[model samples]
Structures are given as C-alpha cells and as structure tokens.
Target: MAKAQDKEAKAAAKKARKQASKERRQQLWQAFQMQRKEDKRLIPYMVGLFVLIVAIFVGLGLLFGSVWLLLPLGIVLGLLAAFILFGRRVQRTVYTRAEGQPGAAGWALGNMRGQWRVKQAVSGNAHLDAVHRVIGKPGVILVGEGSATRVKPLLAQEKKKAARVVGDTPIYEIVVGNDDGQIPLNKLERHINKLPKNIDGKRMETLEGRLSALGGRNPQGPGMPKGPMPGNAKVRGMQRTARRKG
Candidate 1:
C-alpha cells in the first residue's frame, strides 16, 4: 500500500511538472510569435505534427496487436520523438535569425528552453565572440564561439583557470561556427547535455563555490579587466601558437 501511494505521488508530481513545462513553453512560443511575425503559422503546424505522430503510433500499436503495455509506451515515445523534431525546428529558426549578428550566441543561449543553467556573455568580445562555461555532472564544458584561432586561445586560458579550482575535473572545449571543427548551432546544447557526467552534484556545488571568487562577470578579455585573474585564467595557448608560426 505504501509503495502504491509512493507511485501515485510520483506520477502526480511528474504530471504537474509536465503541465508547468507546457505552460512555460506556450508562453515562450507566444512571446516569440509576437516578435517573429513569420513564425505565427508554425504554431499550429507544430501542434498538429505532434498530434499526428501520436495518433499514428497509437494506430500502429492497435493494428499490429501489440502487448497492452505497448500502447501507452508507444504513445509516449512517439510524442517524445515528435517534440524533439519540433524543438530542432525551433532551434533552426532561432539560429537563422541570429546568424551573423553581434551577440547572436548570447541571444541563442539566453532564450534556450527548459531548465538549463547558462551564464550569458560569460566571457566575450564586443563583436559577440564569446566563451560560455556550463558546470554540471557532465563536467566542465567550455563552449567558444568566434574565430577559430581566437577561440582556441580563449578555451585554453579558461581551461587552465577552471582547473585551478576544479582540481582533476574533466574539461571539454568546442568552437561554434561553420569551420572544419565547429559544432553546428542547431545541435550544440543537445551535444553538451548528452555528455557523460564526470563530476557529481556535490562536487559541482563545491567547484561553483570556488569559482565565485574569480570574477562576477567572465569578462570580454583575459582578466575580465575588472577583476584579478583568478588562480586559473591563463593565456598561454595564443602565445604558443604565435611562437610556433613565428
């Protein structure tokens, strides 16, 4: 009986969270629609697509005479798949709008959906070239977007800085653009979030605590220009590359 009650409670909480997320997505879509006059038609199509996918999955399970459990399972899986496509379309639209604009990365990140904890303009240039670090169990992800040459230096410097406070934590870096090595903007967040978590929740909290003393703002340049270069921020990558070429 207790187990049953616990299951019931869990189900209720999950439903509540889903409803809240839907409401938030609706509000966000509505706001996006206002500013994006062209996307107004997409709202209904997006909904209809999801509904159609769900109906098909349900019909398939019934027609195939699958196990009773497959009905709900298929419906859920189908909806997830449809929404994922829906989400990608939304991202592509945003990426299109933000293309080549100053601070485009900042805006793309700022408007990211769901509960991603992102710090904006973390460390960036006036031209909107920037590096954003997101810390979680997936370890330290250093995302750099700008000139490949410039961003590499920034990535190395910040990695060093993060290491001082992060100890032996895992660090990953990627440049965002259409370069030979860059990850496309459409799939950036999914790629980051799907990485294996290296640090546990507690360690992340500790690392964040240590990182707070570094700089309130990640600064556009090496030292934030406004604060002391924490024990970790180093700019050696650029220097070494220069020497190698020279």
Candidate 2:
C-alpha cells in the first residue's frame, strides 16, 4: 500500500511539473509576439550573437582538430546565448512600456525575487501618487511613484512612520523617475539590490514584525487600481517566465 501511494505521488508531481513547463512556454511565446512588434532589432541581435558564438567555437574546434567533438557543444551554447538575448530584449520592452504608468514602481517591486517584503500603496493621495515599502537585508526602503511633487511628501510621511517602528534600522528613500537623483523604473531593482546590507534574516524578520503594527494605508485610495495596470495581465505572465528562463 505504501509503495502504491509513493508511486502515485511521484506521478502527480511529474504531471504538475509538465503542466508548469507548458504554461511557461506559452507565456514566453506570448512575450515574444508582444516584444517583436516594438523591437525590430531583437531577432537580428539574437541571430547575430548566436552566429558569432558558433563561429568562434567552430574556429577553436578546427584549431584543435576536434571539430566533431565541439560542434554539438557549440550549438548548445549558441542557442543559450540567443535565448538570453531574446529574454533581455523582452524585459527591456516590458520595462519601457511600464515606465511612468501609475503604480509602476509598485509593480516592479512586487515582482522582485528574494527575501524582501513589499507593501504597495502604503501612503497615497487622490492624484495616484503613492509610496511603496520594501523590507529586506538592507533594511527598510520607501519607494515613491507618480508626480515628483506629490510623491516626495508621501515618501517623507511614510519614511517617518517607518522610522518610528524600525528604530535604528536603516530606511532608504527612492523616487522613481528620469529626473536627476531619481532611479529610473527599469533600474530600480538594481539600485535596491546594491544597497549595503544592514540586517540578517533574523533581524529582518524582527524588523518586519515591528513594522507590521504600522500597517499599510488604504490601498483603495483615490485613483488606485485594485489590480495590475490595464493590459498588463499577459505581460505579467511573460515577466515571470522570462525571469525563470533568463
């Protein structure tokens, strides 16, 4: 009976994995279609990289008199390089489109991978300007999106609130935009990742617990959409697939 149960569990797990793979492939294909419309050079760049990598490998194989042995390896590497290029182009296109949209910073933060915790629209106003809070190894981060004029105040208020609860924990403030001293939406993730680590996993958890009492402001505040930006549903799926495969 135990053997039969184990076999069934293995089969179910395999089926679930296959289903996930299928979904990922579909999402990637959709992303490719959307990206190619705006990214004319994407294909050319991928093809060029693939050809260049394969040519270099072939040349080395010939020099070593192992053309047959290296040919397969070269082909595999070339394909991987091309796929990486495709994924990068898709990501660029997505970020470009998402930039400046309401809650774009929150959307980006929500997708970040790691031990970070994101709270979107922690403080927002009628104009859709909002501040998002992120807690990670680097401590607390308050990211504001929308008009600089309004977001600045929102960031300040939220930072003050967070400081009250976080004590000595570091609190970083960032405004997402193209303006001087502001992090662009596409580079927001990288900027956050570069912050100096100020806490460990246990410390982070304690910080989070303390801040939890602060809670988030009304998410349904004026002009805030309850879900992702319009037309972003498909793009969101593609983003996940690209992150996994990239």
Q: Please count the clashing residue pairs in each candidate, in the order shown.
A: 2, 0
Least lDDT summed over 10 consecutive residues: which range in candidate 2? Answer: 223-232
What lDDT does each candidate get?
0.61, 0.85
What is the C-alpha lDDT profile of model 1 across 189-230, one tens digit per residue? 667767887777788778777766567445554422221111
Off by over 4 Å in 1: 1-88, 110-117, 217-246
Cα lDDT tens digits, model 2, 1-246, are 999999999999999999988988888888888778878998898889888888888999999999888888888999999998888777777787788778888888988878898878888888888888899999999998888988898888888888888889999999999999899988999999999999999988888788788876745458554335536677776677788998
lDDT of 2: 0.85
- Give the Å error, residue 35, model 2: 2.4
Clashing pairs in 1: 137-197, 161-232
